[model samples]
Target: MGVSKMTGKFLKVKCGKCKNEQVIFEKPADDVKCLVCGEVLAKSMGGKARLKAKVLEVVR
Candidate 1:
């Protein structure tokens, strides 16, 4: 599903390497990283971080 399409949610995405929290849309992404430590989040691609999608609850 798409993030913009998914309203009413705060997409709590977690970093794969540092376990940091980040918000993202459901459309998927690349180069997603931790806002705090600048860690390479998501999956690693030849040493670069690749984005991965995670589901979050939409709190109304």
Candidate 2:
């Protein structure tokens, strides 16, 4: 069996400015910003979040 679509996971990313790590929703309703540098990490496009930086991992 494969993973269900209903079970969504979070995305782990690193800030390009300060290298701070954070977890964000795969499909964020709003823009995801870095807590340290306040840089835009992801942008909501009415569906999945558009990543602005490199993704570290996916948190299941």
Candidate 3:
């Protein structure tokens, strides 16, 4: 069998300012921030998250 796609997926992103790597939801309920440094990694735009950091990979 193959992996089926869901409604949302996890993303691996690196903070632009701190270069800190973190995993966040594609559609986050709230704004996502960097753990190491307080940086807006992803901004919650109601529906989908607006990515501020560089996306490293999409987690399956």
In candidate 2, which residue ranges exceed 4 Å CA deviation?
Answer: 1-7
How many residue pairs in model 1 have overlapping backbones?
Answer: 1
Which consecutive 10 residues in model 2 have the weakest lDDT in total? 1-10
Prediction 2 TM-score vs. true = 0.84
> In model 1, which range of ten residues has the least summed lDDT?
51-60
Tell me how far candidate 3 lies from the true structure as C-alpha RMSD in angstroms. Answer: 3.0
> Model 2, 1-60: lDDT tens per residue?
156865556889999999999999878889999999899999988789899978999887
**Model 3 agreement with the true structure over 1-60: per-residue lDDT tens digits:** 134755788899999998999999889999999999989999999878999999999987
Q: Candidate 1: where is the Cα deviation over 4 Å?
A: 1-10, 28-31, 36-60
lDDT of each: 0.52, 0.88, 0.91
Q: Candidate 1 on 1-60: residue-level lDDT in tens?
A: 455654433356676656666775333335555687776445535343345634344332
> What would you estimate as the lDDT of candidate 1?
0.52
